[model samples]
Structure formats: C-alpha cells, structure tokens
Target chain A: MLTAIAIVIIGVLLFLANMFMDNYQLRILNLSGIYIILSLSMILINGFLGLFSLGHAGFMAIGAYTVALLTTPPMAKQMNYYLDPIVPWLAETEWSFLPAILLGGVLAAIAGFLIGAPVLRLRDDYLAIATLGFAEIIRIVFTNLQSVTNGSLGLKGLPEIEIEIPLPLIGFTLNLSACIWIAAIITILFMVRLVNGSYGKAFKAIREDEIAAEAMGINVFKHKLLAFVIASFFAGVGGAFLGNIMGTVDPLMFRFLLTYNIVLIVVFGGIGSLTGGVLAAIVITAAMELLRFLDSSFDMGPIAVSGIPGLRMVVFSLLLMFIIIFKPRGIMGVREFSWQWLIELPQSIKNSSFGRKKLRKDVSK
Target chain B: MSLLRTENMTMRFGGVVAVSDLNVHLDKNEIIGLIGPNGAGKTTAFNMISGVYKPTVGKIILGKEEVQGGQTVTVEKDITGMKPSAITKLGIARTFQNIRLFKELSVLENVVIANHLRLESNWVSSVVRTPDYTKKETAMYDKSMALLEKVGLAELKDEKSYSLPYGMQRRLEIARALATKPHILLLDEPAAGMNPQESDELMRFIGKIRDEFDLSILMIEHHMQLVMGICERIYVLDYGITIAEGNPYEIQNNPKVIEAYLGVDD
Candidate 1:
C-alpha cells in the first residue's frame, strides 16, 4: 500500500516536472532512462547469472538495425539517398513504432539463443573470451552487411514518435524523453519481478556453484540460456530506443566501448543487485555529462590545468580501479533492496492486524 | 530386496585400478560403513555409486532401476550410462570427502539450491515471481531450516557455509545432502578431520538423522570407533577390492581387516 502511494506521488511529481522542465533536460532524462535499461540487462547476464557476456552491444546493434529497417519511411526519396535498397516486402509494408521495437528485441533474442548454446558450455574466463569473440563477430558482420545495413554509411531519417498522455484535470503530451522514462520504469519493474522469481534464484544458484547446481537437478545450461536470451531482449529494446532517440543508426555506435561502459555500470552498481544497477547507471550517466564541463578550463585564481581532453576518462578509470580494489563486490554486493528495509510502516500495520485478529479470536472464545 | 545393490563394481584411472570387483548391497533404513586405508578406494566406490565416476565395469541397481554411472553398459532393456545429475534425480545424494559447499553463498541459499531439484515451478512462473513460486520458495526455506535444525546448524543459517568451523562444515554438508530429499545419502569421509569428541557427536548425529529421515546412509569413515559404533554392517576394502564384509564386531576381528588397517605380521 505504501508502494502504491509512493508511485502515485512520484507520478504526480514527474507530471509536474514534465509541464515545467525544459526540452534539453527532458532529453537528458530520457538518455539516463535508456542507460538504466541497458545496465539492468547487463546485470541480468553478468551480475546475477555469473556469465561474462561482452556481446551486449551486438544484440543492441541487431535491435537498432531491425527497428531502423522497419520504421524508416522508404517512400521518401531524400531519406533513401544514403540507404541501400530494402527487401521488397519490408519496403512495401508499414510497421508501427512499438511493434518494430518489439521485433528488434525478438531478433536480438534469437541471436542470443544461437550464441548462448555452444558458448555457455565454457567456464568463466573462456566464456568471457567466447562472448567477446561473438561481439566482434557481430560487429564485423554488421559492418560488412553492405546490401542490408548500408555497411558503414548507416541508416538515417527515422520517424519521430510523439506519445500523448490523456490525463484528467491537466492533460499533458509525452515526447521521446517521456517514452524513454516509461521504458526505463517498465524495465526496472520487469527486472525486479524476474530477480525475485524462481528463474532468478536458479540463475543465482548457477552463479554460486555450477557443479552443485547441476547436482541439485538444475539444467545449468538451460537456465543460463534463459538469462542470456532475456538480457539480450531488453538490450535490444534499449538499443532501438537509443537509435530512435538519436534519429539515426550506425554500426560504429555499437562497439566494444559501449559493452565496456555497460559492464562498468553493472560493476559500479554492485553485482547481483537490480537497484544497484539502476542507481549506478544514473550516477555514471549524470557524472559523465557533468564532467563535460571540465572541458572548459577553470580559472582557480592561480593554477589552471587547461581543459584536459582525456581528464574525464582518467578520473573515471581511477574511480573504477579504486572501487574494485576496496570493494570488489560493488555497492550492494549480491543483495537487492527488499521491502523489509522499510520497517516502521509494515511493523505498525502488522501490529494492528495482529491485535484485531487476537480480539476476534477472544470474542469467538 | 536391497534398496541399492552394486555388483562387481570396478573403477580404473588409466593404469591404476582404484576399486575392483566390489560388490555391496544396502538395505533400506540401514547405516552401512565403508572403511579402507588412505588409498583403499572406499571413496572411489562411493563416487561410482553417487555418479561422480562411472565404474569401468559394474551393475548398479537403485531400487528396481539399474543404471551405470561410470561407463556405458549394455542393459537388458537398453544401453544406459546416466549422467551424475540424472543419477541424483534417481534418489541418490552425496557429499564430497573434502567439504564442497558453495563457499560464497549463505547456508540457507545452499539448502535452497539443493531443494531446487524438487521444485515444480516452471521457468516462466519463476521469472515472474508468481504466487506459486513464492509459495514453493517459502516451503523450500522452511524445509531447509528444518534440515539445518536437525543437523544443529540452524543458528548458522545465514552464515556462509565455508565460514563455518570444520565440524560445523561437515554437518552443513550433511544438511545440504539431506536437503536434496534423497532416499539414500552418501557421505564421503563424514568425519575425516574431526577430533574424537566431534567424531563421536557426528556419529550420533548421523544415527539420529537416519532414523528420523528414514534414510539409508552409506558413509566412508576412517574413524573405526565412529564407524563401528553406529554402522549395522561394515565393508572393509584393501588394494582396490572388498576383503571383508560383516557386522561391525565381526569385521573388526577379521584377519583381512587387520591386514588392511595394520600391515600383516610375518
């Protein structure tokens, strides 16, 4: 009940902010939300499941391309100039934004299934190398798929989707930023539900000890595949949103750097904790943006360390190294934020309920 | 009829024959002791029975079902070579000679994972954290806690299994094996490093759980006092073969048993 009230309160606040917040701030919010989804997906595969998959960006590429191919208007001659010829059927058909995004996710999931089958059999470090190889393979394929993906030239001129909220009292319009926030919340809730579920426990069991998990009758490979596929699906969706928000898709955008960034987010958040992942994603994303101001030389009275171009990267790397050395498990370790932490409200409610139950039993006696 | 029976079970590691021509039968609800010197192949036999190693040649029968854990064997009905997980699902659970608890996981989590074999929740239901999944999870926790209580490690339920003391670690291993709800429990050197007091306590504890759980236990123990105190029947092995099999007292007095434990006199 408190959660419901909190959600309502947050929703009202967001609505008010939506009315007054500048377009640039809203866009930043949307970008943060997309990063959260990507980070959460990373946590699912690497953090909770104990699979080091460095091919998340590959899945994202697949989703972004799929969405671009389906949603881009083929009839517009200007938009088609830099693009390669689309297959006749896809060119003729018109798909909505949501379904196109979902289709991209499905394609990514299929790709994940194919890669996970043989690769998940390998242990730890080998698994990491195999997944890294897979990402490289996907990136190379995407870069060379000149006929379908337009090779390195990339896809352009996507439809700008403007979502509208039909609210009572004060009606509001939702743009791309709003959609990203909605998607992020949905991803967060989906992950929370998943980790709290049986499959999540199975994944954690595999993480704890694969041999023991297998001995206990868990088909280790099957559970790992499930986590891999699900994580890829969400990553693909996040990728589609990212491409749409950027208004273009490029093979170069989905690179090893992106995969590494997601890894850093998950690690910074604390492995195996969804709440930690989100918190870390937001903090990291905002920090990176905030640090951009460092590019302008600060005149601190005497010493001016002229706007160092690579300063942000250096500082970020140092922070990561520090965190790893001091607290390798990350912020929350393997623990999630449970409602049990909110003690006062639940305790009061339980006490009143118990008192009422006792009175009822006495009256009956 | 014997609940579990192994006929001429043999295991070879390349040139070395670890266990050879070993025949053993375990009746339901019986405590059987397997004793041998350091390299006596007692654990080798346990490994074969528990599906850790496939016997090079042997027939293993669990209840009415006969399956091979070591190597491919031609059976009357089919060619059967079951995997360790499959064998475990066939109602055999085991612990390692060296404690092999999932070190990073909590004690409760360890038991919960073991109980996963019997969980009926499908992947979809589990991923959704549905009411059914929660119910099953709660039941699993309750069952695991009960098992922990039986093994006197209920206080360490939230502690990491590896962090427990050596004696408590051994008990936790038993608790974890029991969590699998196996019909037959295999303990590989359950009291390997324990002092006299701890070993005696473990022996008593094993007996209490055997009767309470109505489980058939096959234990590999070097501690003669502990083994002889509880085991109804004991099998003595030497140089990769079973040399003596009888009641604990009978086996204790056997010439071959003395030869195996202490070198034979000229």
Candidate 2:
C-alpha cells in the first residue's frame, strides 16, 4: 500500500514538473532515467545470474539501429544511405516511434538468444570478456550491413515522443522526460517483481553454485539463459530510449566504453541488488554531468586546475578507487530500500545522537 | 522391486578406469552404503549414478514407469546420460561431499528453491504475480518452513547458509534435498567434518530423514561407525572395482574389506 502511494506521489510530482521544468533540466532527468533502465538490466545478468556480461553496448546497438531503421523518415533514409541505398523494403517503410522502439527491443532479444546460446558455455572472466566480444560483433555487423544500416554514417532526426494531457482548465505536453521516466518506472517494477519470484531464486541458485543448483533439480543453463535474454531485452529498450532522446546514434556510440558506463553503475550499486542499482544509476549519472567542470578550465577560489584534457577522468578514477578501497561492497551492499525501512531511521538516528552526546560529555570533562 | 539398480556400469577418465563394472541394487526404504579408501572409486560410482558422468559402459536403471498408451519406460533405453536436473526430476537428489548449499541465500530460500523444481508456473506468471502463482509460492513457503522444522533448522530459516554451524549446515543441505521430494537420496559424505558426537547425531538424523521422507538412501562415507551403524547393505570398492558386497556384519568380517577400506585410520 505504501509503495502504491509512493508511486502515485512520484507520478503527480513528475506531472507537475512537466508543466514547470525547462527542457535542459528535463533532458538530464531523461538521461538519468535511461541510465536507471540500463543499470537494472545489468543487475539482472551480473548481480543475479553472476554472469558478469559486458555486452550491453552491443545489444543496445542492435536495438538502436532497429528503431532507427524502422522509424527514420524516407528523406532522411535517402540522405543517410548515400553510399548504398537503404534496402529497398526498408527505404519505403516507416513506423511510429513506440512500436519501432519495442520492435528494437525484440530484435535485441533475438540477438541475445543467439549470442547467449554459444557464450553461456563459458565461465567467469572468460564469459565476461566473451560477452564483450558479442557486443563488438553487434557493432561490426551493423557497420558492414551497408544497405541495411547505411554503413557507418549513422542515422539522425529521430521523431520526438510526444503526448498531450488536458486538465480541467489547463493542459500540458509530455516530452522526453515522460518517456524516459515512465520507462524507468516500468523497468524498476518489472525487476522488483522478477527478483522476488521463483525464477529469480533459480537465477541466484545458479549464481551461488552451478553444481549444487543442478543437483537440486534446477536446470542451471536454462535459468542462466533466461537471465541473459531478459536482461538483453531491456538493454535494447534502454538503448532505443537513449537514441531517441539524443536524436542521433552511430556505431561508435556502442563501444566498450558504453558498456563500461553500465559496469560502473552496477559496481557503484551493489551486486545482487535492484534498488541499489536504480539509486546508483541516478546518483552516478547526475554526478557525471555535474562533474563536467572538472574537464573544463573552472577553478575554485582556493584551488586552481586548468587545461588538463584528461584531468577530470583522473580525479573520477581516483574517487572510484577510494570508494572501492574503503567500502569494498559498494553502497547498499546486497540490501534494498523498502517502505519498512522508514521505521528504522528514527531508532538509528537516536542511537547515533546518544553516542555523540556521550562523546561530547567525556571530552568536556 | 528395486528402486535403483546399476548393471555393470563403468566409467573411465582417459585411459584410467574410475568405476569399472559396478553393479548395485537398492530396494525401497533400504539404506545402502558405498565405502572405499582415498583414491578409491566410491565417489565415481555415485557420480555415474547421479548423472554427473555418462558411464563408459553399462546402464544405470533409475526408474520403471508406465507411459501413455501402456508403454514402459526403462532406464536401459532412457534416463541414462541425461542432464543432472532431468535425473533429479526422476526422483533422485544428492548432497555434496563438501557442503554446497547456496551459501549466500537464506536457509528458507535454499529449501524453497529446491521445491521450485516442482513449480508449475512459468517466469511470466512469476513476474506478474498472478493469483495462482502467489498461491503456489505461499504453499511452497509453508512447506519449506515445515521441512526446515523437520531438520531442526526452523528457527534459523532466515540465516544465511554460510553462517550456520557446520553440523547445521550439513543438516540444512539434507533438508534442501528433501525439498525436491526425491524417492532416493544420495549423500556424499554426510558426516565428513563432524566430531564423533556430531557423527552420532548425523547418524540419527540420516535415519530420521530416510524414515520420515520415505526415501531410499545411498551414501558414500569414510566414516565406519556411520556405515556400520545404519546401512543395511554395504558395497566396498577399491580402484574402480567392487571388492565386497553384503550385509554390514559380513562386510565387517571380510578380510578383503578390511584390507581395502575398513582398516584405514582417520
């Protein structure tokens, strides 16, 4: 009941914000929502199934290209397909944004099934690096399919996702934030349901011990495959959303670094947790954008650092290293945020405050 | 009628034979023991029977079931070399020589996941949490708690498997196997790290599990007291061949059994 109430509150706040917030703020919001969706998918594969797959970028590429191919206007297709005409059927075809996006997810799922069948046979670091190879394979395939994907020139001018809402005497228009936020919420709810189910337990069992899980009558390979395919499906969805939000996509975007962004999110969250992933995605995305000053010639009154092209990356890397060394398990560490946790806050605060008072008294004496 | 029978089953690793020409029979409600010293073929035989390995020669007869249209499915023609999960679905469950509980999961989760082998719902229904699905999950939850109670781990259902005391962890593993509702339970050294007192407790626990679950039992043990105390039938193995097979008293007195396995010190 509280969860339902909290969701409603969030929805109302977002609805109100749609009326007041500027496009710039909304774009960052949309970007964070996309990050949340991508990270949730990462949690399913890496956290629950313990697969440590790095194929998100490749799967996203499949999805983005799918949406791009299906939804790009006829004129845009002609312009982008300068080298070789877009495949005859594709050149003439067009689809609405939502259906095209979902189809993109479906195509990515098919890719996952194909890749997972062969690669899940590997284990540990081999599986991790092998899945990264699958992602590269996706990019390479998209690049070479000149007639189908318009080679490396990429696609642009994706149709904006728009919806109108009318109140009693007022009306508002939905923008990218609407789509991204709605998608993130849907992804979160789906993941929460999945991780609390029998299949989720089965995935965890496979993670815990493949041999023991098999001996217990759980088909380890089947569960692992389920995680892979489902995670890839949502990864494709996230990719489509991101491409639409950015209004452009190229093969270059789906590189190893694209996957590394999600890897950082999952690690900054905790392994085997959903809420941690969502929260970490939001915090990490916002922090990355906020820290943009580090890349430019900005200086504090007390400290000056300027014109070092790679300095921001160095600082961020050090911060991440610090977190890893000190905390080790990352934030939230295998636990999740819950409504009941609200009850524990007062007690924890009281305990800390009581300890502080005692310390202060001892120091004064 | 035999609940399980292996006929001249053989397994070889490259050129070396691990379990050669092994024959064993188990009837319902009987406790059987497989005993051998270090490097002997006891575990290998268990591996073959439990579908961890496809026997190089011979057959593992797991079940005899009448199919639709009155066809009979026998192990000679089927069920051998199947996936371990399929073998487990054939009403066979096993525990590891080293305790291999889902260490990160809670005790209840461990037992509940095992019972999920019998789950009829698909992933979609589980995700949707439909009425039928939640009903099945609740029933499994209650049943898991009950099984944990039987194993004396009821109060510790929410504790992680790795945090449990060693003896409790072993018992927890058995409880997990029982959740699969097996007709036969194969235990790989149920008392491996137990003290003498703990082994005595384990002997009682094993007997209790067999009687209460109505399960036939097969165990590999270097623990003689456990083997001599409970097992009705004993098969002794050495270097991939059966050295002796008989009632415990006969096997205890056999010169070959003593020479091969029983005389070894812990």
Candidate 3:
C-alpha cells in the first residue's frame, strides 16, 4: 500500500512537472534521473563489492554513442559523417529509442565484462588505476573513431525519445520526464531488491573479507564480475538517456572529470546505500547547476568579481572536503531507509535521556 | 580409504622449506591434531591441506564419493592443486587462526553466505524473486537461524559479527565452517587466543560438532590441554619436518617432542 502511494505520488508529480515546468528545469530533472542510475551502478562496484572502479563515464560514453549513432536520423548521419562516412550498415539502420538504449547498455555491459575479466583480480588503488586507464582508452577510441563517432566534430541533431503508453481508467501521457522518472524508479527498485537479497549479502561478504567470502564458497571472482557487468549495464542505459536529453554527443563530454563527479556523489551519499545514491545524485546535480554563478563574473556595486575558469570544481572539491572531514560516512553511511527507523525515531529521541542511564546499567551488567 | 591423506607433502617459500615431505592420514569419524612449537610449520601444513598453499611436491587426497553394495562410500582422490572454493565444494571446510568472519555482515548473514554453495536458485530467479528463489531464501534463513541457535548465538543473530565478544566470534567461526557441511573440518589454532575456560568449552564444542555433524576433524593447536584431552592421534612437527607421530601418550612422552618443545643443546 505504501509502495502504491509512492508510485501514484511520483506519477502525479511527474505529470504536473511536465505540464507546468519549463524545458530548462525539466532537462535538469532528466539529467538528475540519469545520474541516479549511474550512481547506483557506481555504488554496486565501489560500495557493495568494495572494488574501486573509475570506468562509469567510459561505460556511459559507450552507451550514449551507441544510442546517438543508432537513433540519429539518416539525414543527420549523412551531414555529420563528412570526414568519413559512417559504415554503410550502421548509417542505414535507424532504430527506435527503446532498442537503441538497450543496445547502448548491452554494449557497455560487454565492455565491462571484457575489462572486469582481467582487472577484477586487482584490488584497491591498482584496480582504480586500471579502470581509470580503461576509461581513458575508451575516450581515445571515441576520439579516433571518425567513421562511427564523427571524430572531434561530434554528433548533433539527435532524436528525442517519445513513447506513450495508456492505462485504462487512468488517462496519462508518459513524456520524456515520465520515462526518466519511470527508469529511475525501476533502477532504484531493482538495486534495492538486489542489495537486500542473498546475492547482495554475498557481495557485502566479499567486500568485508575476500578470503572469508571465498572460504564460504561465494566464488569471489564471479561475484565481482557480476557487479561490474550489471553496474555497467545500468550506466549504459543512463548514458542513452543523457544523449537523448542533451541532443548532442562528444568524446570530451565523458572525461575522467565526469566519473570523478559521480565518485563525489557516491561518497557524498555513503557507500553501500542505494537510497543514498539516488538522493545524492539528484542533490549534487542540482547543486552543480545552481552553482553555475560561481563560474560567472558578477558585480557587487563598484566591486567587480571576475569569474574564474573551473571555479565550479573548486567549490565542488571544497564541499567534498567538508563532507569527508565532518561526516566521513556520507549522508547515509551503510544504513538504508527502513520503516522500523521511522516508527522508532520519536520513541528513541524521547528515550535519549533515560536511555543513556539505562545503557550504562546494561553494559555494567 | 582415509578421509584425508597427504603423501610426501612439501612446501617451499623461496629457498626456505616451510613444510617438508610430511605424510599423514585421517580415517573417517576420527579426531587428529597437528601441534608444534612457534614457527614449527604446523600452520603451513594446514595451509597445504586446505588448498591455501599449493604443495611444492606431494599428493593431498581429498575424499571423493562412491556407492558400494547399496551403501555410499568415500574414496580418496589426489586433490593436490584445487581452488579453495572447489575444495570447499568437495566437503572440506576450514577456519582460520585470524577469525576472518565477514565482520560487517550480521551473524546470520555470515552463516547464510556459507550456505550459498547449496543454493539452487539461479540469477534470473533470484532477481525476479520467483517462488523458487523466495523459498530457497526462506529455507536458508531458517536453516541459518537454527545453526546460530545451536551455537548459542540466536539472540545475537542480528548483531554485526565484529561486535560479538571474542569468544562468541570464535564460536561463530566454527559455526560458519560447520555450515558448509564439510566431510572434514580443518581448524587452524581455533583455540589460540581462548582462555583456559574458553578452550575447555571449545573442546566440548568440538566433540559435540564432530558427533552431531558426522565430521572427521584435523586441527592445529598450541593448547596442549585441549590437544591431549581430545585428539585421538597427534603429529608433532619441528622446522617443517615431522619429528613425531603417535597416540597422545606416545607423543607426550617422546624425548624428541620434549627437545623440540623445550630446547636442545646447540
């Protein structure tokens, strides 16, 4: 019943936002939705599996490029592929948004599997560095793949994804925002289901102690690979959404900075918490957009404050430092949103004074 | 055939011999002990048998199964260099001296993870939460809780494993090993840090699990009281070589054992 209420509320809010909100606000919302998917993916590898991976942006780029190329109109493909025409087969095949997004995710998942097979053996900083290298390799490949990706010129005039489904007795039009919201909700739900299950328990076991996990017959390597591949799949889907919303794609857009921004969000939300990932993704993305003023020049009456290039990043780093220094566990730590917590909150707070006294008595016993 | 057998087992680290040409065997439904002084290669021998260290040269036979005369029988096969999980699947389970429980997981989760080897639900079913998946999980949960109860940890099943007291953590380790349903239990100094009272309790616990779980046991221990009290046969090692092997009385009285435990003239 609570889930039903939540879904209905989300659906109502989505419809209202689509009808009332301007395109700029709607675009930001869409981007945040995509980030929710990506960050959830990152948390799986980095948080649950305790593997330091820096390849999400690479996966996203693969996903976005796959969607961009597949869904681009044949005319746009002809215009963009001036340097070297896109391969005959790919240029000719114009796929719908759904299959195109799935293709993007599948391709990214394949890349993740290939990369994870070799580097999943590495742990800690080494794995981070290897994944970072893979991201760089993917970037370079996109830059040089003129025929497929249109090289540095990038691709524009990407098609918008439009799909509408009707529900009987509940007349509603599901637009792009609705689609994004639906995907985000599904991704969050899927992640929650996974992280709360036996398989998720196995991942946490491996994270806590690889040797112990292996001794318990969890197959540590296989679990790590599973996380890497699944996370990649979601990251890819998120990327496809990003391309459709932005209406452009470029290799430069998926630099290490993109992955680093996601890392900041993951850490900000707390590792091993799916709710944290979703919440932090939206908050961080909104803050990034709102903090655009820091990068722009402004005047305080007679005093002119000249804008600094990359000032946004400086502020971001400062925020990250503050969170790490003060609340190192991030907003949620490893704790999830539980109904029991809600029921117990008031009672616990009221018990604080007497609870302190009673705790000492129990411990002394 | 013996439940476990090692023939001419040796382990070399660089130029140093950690364990050298040690031959030993344990029959079904028997308890055996490996004891030695500090740096006596006792743990190294355990490591070899448990597949933590591949032997430099040896035959380590983990029991295989066969049916004989309408009854099941365990036959020995050379499992010299198998992965630890593979060895675990073959019904050999072990606990480390370090008490390497999944500390962040709840006590019940630790046991359930060990039970994962027996999980028949595939990824698709687990994701979809099909009746098969949910049923298996429910069974696993009940089974894990029962194991916790037997270990006297049912009340603390929801607690983080690391937050448990030291003795309870030690018991949790043993419970985790038993969860795998191994044919043989290899405990590497399970009683290492336990006090005399705790070690005594551990001895009873060991015997109880042996009978209850139908296990053949091989453990490395420095606790002489526990070793002499419970072990049917004991092997003594000194500097990677077996110095003595006999019944408890013979090992206790052996002059070489005394020399190794005490000290010989340089």
The prediction achieving the highest DockQ against the true structure is 2
DockQ of 2: 0.86
- Candidate 2 clash pair list: none
* Cα lDDT, all candidates: 0.82, 0.87, 0.89
How many residue pairs clash (N, CA or C atoms closer than 3 angstroms) in each of the candidate models, in the order given? 4, 0, 0
Interface RMSD, in order shown: 2.0, 0.6, 1.0
User: Per-residue lDDT for B164-203 in model 2, tens only?
Assistant: 9999999999999999999999999999989999999999
- Superposed by TM-score, candidate 1 places the C-alpha of residue B47 at a distance from the truth, in angstroms, of 3.1
Candidate 2 — what's its lDDT?
0.87
Q: Rank the candidates by DockQ, best first.
A: 2, 3, 1
Cα lDDT, model 1, residue A303: 87
What value does DockQ give for candidate 1? Answer: 0.44
* RMSD list, candidates in order: 7.4, 3.2, 3.7
Candidate 1's residue-wise lDDT over A91-162, tens digit each?
655577778888999999999999999998987789888988898888889888776777787877777755
Could you give candidate 1's per-residue lDDT for residues B1-266 as a string of tens digits? 67788888889999999999998988889999999888989888877886667889977877733457975443332112466677777678888887778788788888878887788877777656678878898898889888888777888889977889999888887888788878889988899899999998898898888988889999888888998999999998888988899998899799888887788778
List runs of model 3 lying over 4 Å from the truth.
A164-173, A299-303, A353-365
Q: Is candidate 1 or candidate 3 better by DockQ?
A: 3
Residue pairs whose backbone atoms clash in candidate 3: none
Q: Give residue A144's lDDT in candidate 2 (0 to 100).
A: 88
Q: What is the lDDT of candidate 3?
A: 0.89
Model 2 CAPRI rating: high
